[model samples]
Target: MLWFNPRHPSFFYYNTSTANLKSNYQVNTNGLIGQTTALQSVVSWNKTITKCRQNSQIIKAQKLFDKMPLKDIVSYNTILPGLNQAKNPEKVCQLFLEMERVGLKPNEYTLSMIFSAALNTELKLLVSQIHARTICLALNASVFVGSALMKAYADAGDGVGLGKVFNEIFNKDVSSWNALVSGYMELGRMHEAQKTFDTMPDKDVVSWTTLVNGYIRNKRINKARSIFNKITEKNVISWTVKINRYVQSERFVDALKMFVLMMRSDTMPNKFTYSSVLDACAGCCCLLVGQQVHSSIMKFGIPKDVVLSTSLVNMYAKCGDIDAAFSVFESVQRKNLASWNSMIGGYCRHGLGKRALEEFERMIKMGVKPDEVTFVNVLSACGHGGLVEEGEKHFDSTETKYGINAEVKHYACMVDLCGRAGQLDKAEKLIKEMPFEGDVVIWGALLGGCGHHSNTKLGELAAEAISRLKKDHPALFSTLTKIHGEKGARSTVVTLRKILNEKRFRKQEACSWVESPFHEM
Candidate 1:
């Protein structure tokens, strides 16, 4: 339900059990911390590494890794997962280079990290290289290792590699199957994922949920529900699975039905269930459903959870009841960053951009550091509400004061603002100054303001930029069409429509879940 809950993951009471992501580490650096058993075994050293990476103290973990009496393949393996978690997967490569420099043998885990880090196109090349290296190293690929490999290939959009590595495994475990299935689901490969799942020797909650999640994620609700109904024994995950699907799919009635069914089945819905059901209400844009869910949340009080509270606020806001949203927000005793972000987005969405600004300022005054996402929406508000000077000051502050580099979205907002104010040259100059590739959204934003200001020349340039995007985004195409039509370019509109007709186009739900992607702009 919440597009963005900025609260720390630890503060959120999720339904699932604590998973020790591979290559974890424990943090006992502080004096208040307990014994320092520099994880000797590879078995759980990864957990320790994870702790270090989480604390932004990977350097300490690195030191511990260096001092370990006997560093196994898992030792090197441990570092890569930490880097992978940081989202700086390039660091995984750097670590690999370091490994090569140190003369340590690169194991399957090492290669898997590289594969995991590769996104989209790069995944294809890396997966092949990793698969080949697996054979070259003569490494005995364990189920875990093989699963990781399948996961990498699946993530890369290489179904070929996914099938190849998956087929090679003689004795597959639940995790291996889950990995492959999850990968397929992630890449929207439902057909392949389903086929692989059908053959899984044993099915667990993870297996069933992965399929349901795949269907839900791919917007295949009917198939997901069909499989969900067949799940004989439902756990929290099972309930959450269906509830999550309905919430995401905006099927409020179905989610509520499933929740009731879960209670009847003697499976208690967890925080995720509550959050998702609230989300379904939000999606439905029905105030009554949200009120009902709110009462339910009250009856089964999850007092300390920041996420659920945030979800409630979002549900109320989305259901066209900002009064209720603020009422619940005010009731929250332990408000966190997500709480603020949700309320801000809700305000912004409801044409209360000024109020959103006030909330963001409240967050800053409360000493909560705003992430990039916070600035995006605030910048958007600046443009929409005509707070040009305020917008520029905040934009400049991101780099000059906070030391956070200005991303292109911020640049887009500034450009849009200036263009709306008839400062076309300033918008173009800002576009040129942007470090990242400007998206169609940015160019289109400028073009929109240009059109509003009747600046046809800049509009043409914005159209050109929109045309240059490597991949076609439907909304961008639509915006260009509108601009062209307004500027009397009916021929271009016809051409755009023809180009669009060649492809089966589905307008992805206009709802960009992301606050500015769950609470940013």
Candidate 2:
């Protein structure tokens, strides 16, 4: 039965059945021939299942797995990976149990797949049991298995378990070190992550990038930059990390300068690089820089990625080029929720409240669901246009229609909407009945509304509420003082400044920056 013919050297071509054998295809039929044929069928099934899995035909793979005549360790290994890839970890567990029931032992590959799936499943207890099994099977020394175990424990936030697995790894490679470092970073264990990076026998760009990113997360931007500058071979990602760090810190000028330097270099900018630079341009409202970025985007001929397109819309909008913003919005081949939100926000900012509302309606009709930001933009439009009824309807429908909970910003928009229409009582009532307490921004919104209506009484209440928050909002305080002065309350205005000075609440110094076309940092 285990015999191989000279003409047909493959197991798949080995036929033991007497009915199928011809003069040209000869086979020896022994007592083990039936078992050999069955084994051959199993092998064929395994190949089919593997092919199906590779093609991402998970359902078909499952069907093939279920219909197998006889399953073996190979069969289980073949299907388990596909199951894990499909995010069917529960199914993997069930199959593992089934393999055990049939007296089939899982190999190290099977254990690795389980750990990979378990990371996402958050099945910490199950992973623990699997770890014990790996130990009992004496497979813990495997670098592949050890890496997966480390990652699983890290994802579960089980740092101790991760360390134990790392200690047991016999041959730790760069990947192994990266997994542990990333794990430490994710858990905010910067010291431990840094220690691991320092002790690594070989450090790749990924290792450096991970530590740099960790420092950024911990708000150690200078340390991140210092580490970034030390990398001898800088990749696009390293440049992006620095650019992203600048963008996150609101250092728009620096971000744009980095981008310009990146463009001058041989390393081409990707979508993310363009996105960050566009964000900087938007922040600074630099139309020329934004237009330059727009031209680069065209020259690069990058695909219309949603994020890049949305950033372009935001850039143009913030630059006060509403027409260009709309043009970008319309040019988007597929407008996602972000694209719509940007357009609506652009309209709202330009005080084209009617157009913003129209876009909002069109968004809903086109079956694109509105998010919290969507409501924020639309409600803000309503406030600007004095559409109190529309604002109320949208606010009410936030939870019921869109399944989005009304956040503080949404409530602030509602308050502002009512206040804009001179419905001070309604605005006050809404604030009083809010689910959560108002923040400085919420009160500031109400105060601004009061200023617009010259409602000194409500303005006083709003100002008092803000004062109690003990925030250093100099602009709000200045506005309140101006409102009091207008209402013939000179003493009250003077007293407010005295209270501010007594509390040692000095106004924050405002700083702004612009990128120079001639000089690139």
Candidate 3:
């Protein structure tokens, strides 16, 4: 009779009325059963490790891997990627060495992960060692490995190495081409990037976007737009890049027009797209356009994550709608540091120093740590509200309590704070005591205070410092002229005015935005 083994479903046992059956069965089946069970265990372990990695429990995955009684190449491959994801390049290299010690050879996937890990590290020697290994193993021909090597070399700024890897690819895919183009772009070699992009037989959305982004990075907006226009199939990323570059260039109107065109297309605008659009609205202070975007965001039912919520807060605040900004801030389920900073900045912009300070306190109470930007806004609020004591306390606490070294901008804020409260002597003393040399901003702050207090001597000193730093600064000469005139120095004012005329100095005209029924300007 043949009896099926339920535990090992694929195997069957033959039982007969013979005394030799037991020994025969054991001899034939023990090795096979043991191998089958071991294989099953490895597979099960791999699944658990993969689950741990997917859940971002990399430490748990490493622990499981350490406890494994048996490990194969697949086990190393599985855990190596998790370590790479965790940005532990040292651990990845260590495990790779361990694999070598255990007599396991790495496959293409292993080399790819190692190359990825190498990209994050600045160890040129480690990269060379890995490259030599790939050549020895003849795995350099692998498209996967080749692309990764190109990226690693690109990041190292080794154009020669990148070129060598690209030439060695056995079957060049679009990814390989894209990698080369991206490498050139990263190195700021736009000509080479364009040449490689043009030579590609097949182009995906990523390829197009990469080239466009490369042009934008190199500050070739016209070239970027030309490439963007040629893309037959434009994805959200493609459109977003164009719009974002427009915003960055301060071409807010162009960004809005692009957004309008993007909406007319089938591709839906994502959170990033909306963020850029909001920035454009803020730039021009177009409240109507901002409200329309807010309506669209609600209509699309997009989840207001921290980034999007923060963007909305900034837009509303900049467009002179503080109430709406605060409402958006309140609605955020999970507020981040940026969210708090934006709210505080909004209050400062509107001269609500007390409110801004209150918000800062609320942020600290909620355990959100303040960064350099946070303190800048807070100090500016103190300057606006004439809270000199409060500003000095926060400024001092920045380094002592928060461990954030006061930067030049922080010093400028302090100068402004003191200068505003008519403490011109204190402001000048602060500048002289600064560890770093005072810049034009610091001098300008002191000069403004001098002009307000009619101190011609200190004003001349501030003007001289400004002239030394920025010779062509029209505002410096203009402000200095005003200081001299206020001090009844008619001859000095006349000389400054003549110099300004000769230099063709003109102050930038300030403009305000107003919505009309027919159009906007």
Candidate 4:
């Protein structure tokens, strides 16, 4: 028989490697045997449960927990964390209730787990109960639990709750400050977020980046740039965010300049960085700079990355090099849907409709699902090539065959197709019967087709529709006036001039793309 010490837990050590298998163990104290045995059982169960949890065997861990004959506060705490890690918040709450039922008092760790679990679930009343428990137990003053509560309130968009939690944290750390700033940013309260950031005793990279991202989210690009320049220690994320922002804002030239600066600073670009810069080149139709970027991509030894490959295809295609785009497409071995869409759109843009059609058929045959974008390109190809039958077939199959509801853009393509094929009646009927209202693009397509066919009656009607939205579009009005004048509709021309005079409309200067020669880096 082996004797166990009741007072000191560290005194008990069972070395199964050397101990006799048939030996019995008991507490040395006469009446404390049951208590010591229960303690030992709790420790053993906790060890096994923790091991199972670490190995991602939560189900096994729960089974062992359920089978344990003795459970203490430690047992409840161990299993609560495991359940939270497994993303079973509901089970975490259930286990918490069991802890309460058994009269086990919760520590700060347990309360933190409860708050963290409640933050993600849709159980509003759970948070309220947890908050009440924290108040009752006076655990609300704990920094760890307080921070968790702050984050939960932030996610719930309860400004009052967040403020209450923030004030409850008497000793705030960097994480506490970050949670408040991030919460404000998430809620789109830029002024409040900036204010909190300014009041922070020390600002880390995260603090700076959060404010920058907040400015970007609010569409204050200039302010975001201002804050970005103030960061002395900029990382790749800082550079990438600003670069992508310029691309999104359509400031392609500035975006290219920023990329050049980033390269000079020795800050390496990631796949997203390369993709955004390539998009900037494509937007400006800068073929020379685009090729230079391609060379840079190869030099970096990540030329085959699927996303970068797709961007390259898009860049080359938009710059009027369909062959280069096709070459890149063929080079990618594992092509995603985006890669196929880029290639098809490239062919459509360059007026190689028959080739685009062939690629579309091949895409479908390969069992790669084409999305709404693919069909947009496909319908455009058919429309440009005057393949009205093919266009109609694809248009009709959008909802039935592909599970993609035809959006307004797809309908606009169909209208352009019918209008281009001299089926104006079909186009008009389709527009009127569409589930949604036709935008300016749809009417503009009809007017372009009317101009091509010299149909003054429909042209006047389409121009009138456009005028309702774009009251000051001088070029569209000028085109309509010319069409009406040629068809001897002097009354319509006079009416257009009257509307133009009343609105004080002016014809804007034409903007053209002028790409400069690329200087080798």
Listed in order, each prediction's TM-score against the native is: 0.67, 0.69, 0.72, 0.66
Candidate 4: regions farther than 4 A off = 1-188, 490-521
> After TM-score superposition, what is the CA distance of residue 123 in candidate 4 from its true location, in Å?
15
C-alpha lDDT score of every prediction, in listed order: 0.72, 0.80, 0.84, 0.79
lDDT winner between 2 and 4, please give it: 2
Lowest lDDT 10-residue stretch of candidate 4 = 512-521
Could you give candidate 1's per-residue lDDT for residues 1-521 as a string of tens digits?
Answer: 00111342111111122362211133224411311222224436656765786665666777767665444445677676766664566666676766655445676667767767765434356667767767666652567667877777766677777777767777778888898898888888788889989988988988998898889989888888898888877789878877877866667888888877887887767788888888887877878877887777678775637798899998998888998899989988878777888898788787787999999998899877676777877887777687888988999888787667888767777887777677778888888878877776677677666766666677778778776863565654655666777788889889878767776555544432212331122
TM-score of 3: 0.72
Which candidate order results from sorting by TM-score in descending order? 3, 2, 1, 4
RMSD (Cα, Å) of candidate 3? 9.9
> How many residue pairs clash in all the candidates, one count each?
24, 0, 0, 0
Model 1 TM: 0.67
Error of 2 at 372 (Å): 1.3
Model 1 error, position 315 (Å): 2.4
The per-prediction CA RMSD against the true structure, in angstroms, equals 11.4, 9.5, 9.9, 11.2
Best by lDDT: 3
Compare candidates 1 and 3 on lDDT and give the better one.
Answer: 3
lDDT score of model 1? 0.72
lDDT of 2 by residue, 305-364 (tens): 889999999999989999999998998887888899999999988889999999999999
Worst 10 residues of 3 by lDDT: 512-521
For residues 1-521, write the lDDT of model 4, one tens digit per residue: 12233455433333234443322344356435655665677788899999998866788899999998767667878888888876778888888887776555688888888877886578544676688888898888778888788777777778888888888878888888887887777677888888999999988887788788778777788898899889999888878878887888788998899999999999998888889999999989999999999998889876468898999999999999889999999999988789999999999888899999999999999877778999989998998898889899999898889778998778878878888888888888888999987777777777766766777878778878877866556656766876787788899889988877777887545321001110010
Off by over 4 Å in 1: 1-82, 103-116, 119-125, 131-140, 184-192, 249-257, 260-266, 320-337, 351-355, 358-369, 397-408, 420-425, 428-440, 447-521
